[model samples]
Target: MPNIQLIAPCLWFDDQAEEAAEFYTAIFSNSQIVNITRYGEAGHEMHGKPAGTVMTVAFELNGQPFIALNGGPAFKFNEAISFQVICQTQEEVDNYWEKLSAGGDKTAQQCGWLKDRYGVSWQIIPNILLEMLNDADTTKSQRTMTAMLQMKKIDISELLQASAE
Candidate 1:
């Protein structure tokens, strides 16, 4: 039996598992590809994948283990499940937003939420968002929520300005 780690997110892709794994490893710190599994003749007929084709890739993103499966086009990524990227600064948020949104569905981008080229939804959140939303005063949090809903990318300064109102 494979020594599987407790629980790790598995991303499904249409023959782009290796590409997606490479993309994510480049995006986050403390990341690397741990292993890659290829299909073999034994399951070629059952899986319908050619021998030697990539089956899965195990990788780490910000030290979190994840697997990307080249599971074909029977399924696709949707917005129902999204990965939240908590950033310490607006620069971090902007950088990720720009990188992740490249070649993706730009029309679907709003409220700091965007689908990457792989159709994977991601939330690029500013760290201050938590503090703002958790403020002791509900009005401040409400105002912050209002500000957040108005923008495509989160603006820390703007959120602060709204909280001040």
Candidate 2:
């Protein structure tokens, strides 16, 4: 077999690393738990504690690698950087929006941006959004962008309608 190496996004949680990993894996298709390694006594320096205490977890979401670290609650997910998921259809957008918005604050911005319960920001955008943004007609593209700027989560149909006008 070919060398199977994966570099995943490692998330640090305040004692909720496992919970968050499970939550994320369940949300996306083609995803599953790969491994869960706890801290051990010998690896104190690696984890700042004895080994066997959930030092790292490896999981996959839609074939994307992700790791969760049970680090103490020193920092949190902020709006500065967010995961942008491009949906091929409006239904996909709606599904992610509904699921991610659970127990989280929802803000409707022009293009597409919403904050989840974990205080993590996400942008649920339609796949065609980029195409519309790069339309040959600058005016139309600007109008679409303007419409998107006014809302939080993007509605592809609405954006297309706005661009047509």
lDDT of 2 at 38: 82
**What are the per-residue Cα lDDT tens digits for candidate 1 across 1-165?**
987579999998989999999998998889999999999899676678999999999999998999999988999999999999999988999899999898899988889899999999999999899889999999999999999999998999999999998
Candidate 1 TM-score to native: 0.95
List model 2 lDDT by residue over 35-112, tens digit each. 998877775765585556677788998988888888877889877778888899989999988888787875533357
Residue 142's lDDT in candidate 2: 95
RMSD per model, one decimal:
2.3, 2.3
lDDT per model vs. reference: 0.93, 0.80
Output the worst ten-in-a-row residue range by lDDT, candidate 1.
39-48
